[model samples]
Target chain A: MIDIFTKFSGQLFVGLGWTILSSVIALFFSLIIGTVFAIMEVVPSKIARFIGRAYVEILRNIPLLVITMFFYLVIPKYVMKINGFTAGTIGLTLYTSAFIAETIRSGIQSVSGGQMEGARSTGMTYWQAMRYIILPQAFKIVIPPLGNQFVNLVKNSSVLAFVAGFDLMYQANSIASTTFDQINSYLVVGVLYLIITLPLSYYMQYLEKKLA
Target chain B: MSMIEFHDVQKYYGHFHALHDINLEIDEGETVVLIGPSGSGKSTLVRTVNGLETIQKGQLIVNGHDLSDPKTNLNILRSDVGMVFQHFNLYKNKDVLENIMLAPRIVSHIPEEENKKRAMELLEMVGLEKWAHNMPSQISGGQKQRVAIARTLAMRPKLILYDEPTSALDPEMIDDVLQVIKKVTNESGMTSLIVTHEMGFAKEVANRVIFMDQGQIVEDENSASFFEQPKTVRAQQFLSKIISH
Candidate 1:
């Protein structure tokens, strides 16, 4: 293990950087997309709700790797040219957004209906009430679940390995192939993932407590 | 001119009729109490004023807006109509002060400095000034209702609706919430339509009382006369039932 770390430290760090970058990008885009779809699912218009429901249902049911592969292999061949990293990140974002939308929609529903009534009775518009009163409460209610989704999202970024996006898992594969020390290589990768996930788990718990 | 007018208003929840042939008028500055057994449409009628519930058939005009018109803008009317609910419904994400100041700031665009000043004054009026920073969950039920009242009053609405505001509180907490409402209405001279089972409080604050049964107004009379001699048989039975308990 020590020898593998000493020889592959630079490659491992590069992989770690790429993993972090992809996760951050996916997290940011996914949250916005998820929230929009969540709102659409609940809005008064049936058409909007249908669109939101369809998006969430279709994307969430598809396997994440298949979606990633389509973007990687198909989009480049059909209409546009893009790198493996871009394709993987977009796939991750859309897939994770579907789950986030579901989480947030449930959170929104959990808030008392009276909150919207109270806000609207004060003369706030529907969107206004939703923005100020409903969404804030919904987000608070969903923090724990959302934190779970975020952790899942980060781990799932490992899907990038199959597409040559060069994430941590990709580095482990390369190191194992070169060094013939598969156990130690993958072990190092697993520990690094723990380093990311454990702190995130703790931070979410802290946030839930502080908000409560 | 009357502040609210409902001419032959009818509401239906699919096959079940909720409000039927409702012809009513509420003048400005008049405090009216609406009393009825559960499912009697008192709540449904009050909600229609704020467009929380829409009337199906009839002309309903509130604060000069013809609510029956498809183009009527309800948001404009809502700004001048405040509502206090049985559940209090204070914004759980906001502190007491923010709950009071939010509508005034966002809906009406009151200047921050002035909005804060008026919010504090309203808080003081409700006797919850010290609870300015407390979250809704941290407060007692009565205190939360007071904050909710302050929140409604912050909009400076010309009319206020109380939908069984004290019904959800403990027996001991009811008086505190009622007292704040009494003081607020008297000081502001705002038109109020209250739906409550608190007969004593209704008799004290209401100039007139309306009795409802099975989605119809059975009697509308002066509070003093109605309490002393309820005209309709339904009103008599209803009053006796509630007063006995």
Candidate 2:
């Protein structure tokens, strides 16, 4: 067991690299997509709001693994030949964006109606008021909840394993199967997950306090 | 030309008429006070001039822009018509100075230095120059309302609307806010429309008083005439009740 652990330590580090890569990709795209959807949800146009609501409902209700599988297994078979890593990252982004949209929508709503009225009464166009006054205040209110979504996004990247995405959990599974050291292999993987999640959790808490 | 004109203006909040066949005019530099019991639509009437509340029927014109026309550019109308809400409604995230400067900087596209000078001047006028950097949350209710007034004045609007500006303040604080308002309206020659429960402030500061009840204007008279001998029974009852308290 000890020898197996020593031998697989390098692979664990490599898996850590894939996990970090997946998380970074998902975080980058999700924030952009989420912000777009959030804007759409708040915009006065009926069609825009409907589209935004439909996207959030559809993405949020489906299981993350199902979304990953749809992209990995279903899409490549017919529409495109995307690989597991791309598939998993796309799935993660879509899933996380739905939650972020809801979080940001509530944040925007939490800002007092008087603020918008005050801004509009001062001759600001709707978009101008939203950009300058409403969004700045909404972003502040959404920070703590947004941090939680980000941390969850990082952990949810493990769904990459089911699609042969070569992430941490995938490497852990391969090591455990080959080495026949199930408990120890998973224990090591669990520690690796903790190593990623613990600091992320701490950082989010730190940000919440700093922003507050 | 009249600064504001509401010609047969009507508003309904889903079958409940909020403003009923309102026809009135406010000339430039005239200080008109609207006095009424709660739910009498005084606030709603003033809010329509700024297009905060849309009038569902007839022409509502401010500074030559017809609010009843969908094609009318409300933003331009609002730029010339400023409002100070009863609750102050100061942006809580901003400091007193930022609250005053934000509209000028963002909406008017005024240069930062120039806007700061104007904001400082308004703050000094309101006697809150010392609280420039203090957040709205840090200020008293009266101070916040005064800052709200200063914020309105920063735009140099042709007309200003005060919607029960002293109604939300404590008894001790109401006088201070009223005094600032009195000084501003007295000194600026700006067209002012105030909806207030403070009869004394209205008598002292307003040139004319309009009494409203059940979404209708009961009487429109000069301040001395309105207070000394209210013609309508509703106006008399409202004044008696308010004065008794």
Candidate 3:
């Protein structure tokens, strides 16, 4: 195990950097897309709800690897050229966004109907009521579940390994094959994944308490 | 001029008829109190005036805006017509002062400095100035209602609707809320329509009283006459039942 670490430390660090970058990019874009879709699902417009529902359903139902491969293999060949990293990050974003949308939609629904009524009765527009009153309260209610999605996102970035995106899992696989020490290589990667997720969950718990 | 007029209004919640033939007119500066048993369509009637509940059949006009017309902007109408709910419905995310200041600044686009000043004055009027920074959950139920009233007043609406304002407060807290309502209505002299079960409060503040049952108006009379001698047998029985309770 020590020898594997000494030999592959540089490769492992590069993989760790790519994993963090992809997760960060995916997390940011997914949150924005998810919130927009969540709002669409609840908005009074039938067309918007249909579009939002279709987007979430289609993305969430498809396998993550299939979606990534479509972006990697199909899109570059037909429409535009893109690297493995870009394709995997985009895939992670859309996939994670669907779950986030569902989580956030539940949170929005959980907020008392009276909150929207109160804001609307005051003459604020639907969007205004949603922005100032509903969304803030909904976000607070969903922090725990949202945190779960964020952790899942980090773990799922491992899908990048199949596409040669050079994320942590891909590095672990390579190191284990070369060093013939699969157990230690995978164990170390698992611990590193925990390092990202544990703090995130704790931070969410802290946010929930602070808001409460 | 009438502030609110409902002609043969009908409201249905899918198969259930919530309001039946709500023909009513409320003139400017008149304080009317609607009293009825639970599920009597009193709340539905008030909500319709501000376009909160749409009428499927008939003409509903409030502050000269035709609520039945699809072209009519409900947001504009709602700014002129304020509603107070049974549960107070103060914005949970905002503090007492922000609750009052929000609609004015956002809907009316009032200058922030002036809006803040007016909000403070309204809070002072409701005697919640000391609690300006406190969140809605931090306040008592009665205080929340009072803050709600202050929030409504911040818009300086031409007409105000109170849908069972004291219904959610504690027994001891009801009086304070009723007092504030009385004071605001009397001083502002705005067209006030209140739905309440407090017969005494109704008798004190209302010039007219409307009695409703099973989604229909059973009696519409001057407060004094209605309280003294409810004309309809249904109204009399309802009054007697309430009095006994």
TM-score of 1: 0.97
Candidate 1 lDDT by residue in tens digits, B97-202: 9999999999999999999999999899888899899889899999999899999989999999999999999999999999988998788899999999999999
Native-referenced DockQ of model 1: 0.86
DockQ of each: 0.86, 0.71, 0.84
As a whole number from 0 to 100, the lDDT of residue B101 in candidate 2 is 93
Better of 1 and 2 by DockQ: 1
lDDT values of the candidates? 0.94, 0.90, 0.93
lDDT, candidate 3, B1-245, per-residue tens: 99989999999999999999988999999999999989999999998888888889999989999999989998999998899999988888889889999999989999999999999989898888999999998999999999999999899999999999998889999999999999988998899999999998999999999999999998999999999999999898988998999
Better of 1 and 3 by lDDT: 1
Off by over 4 Å in 1: none
Off by over 4 Å in 3: none
Candidate 3: TM-score, chain B only: 0.98
| lDDT string, candidate 2, A121-191, tens digits | 77888887888778888888998888889889988999999998888889889999998888888888888
Which residue pairs collide, candidate 3?
Answer: none
CA RMSD, predictions in order: 1.4, 1.7, 1.1
By DockQ rank, best first, the candidates go 1, 3, 2
Ranking by lDDT: 1, 3, 2
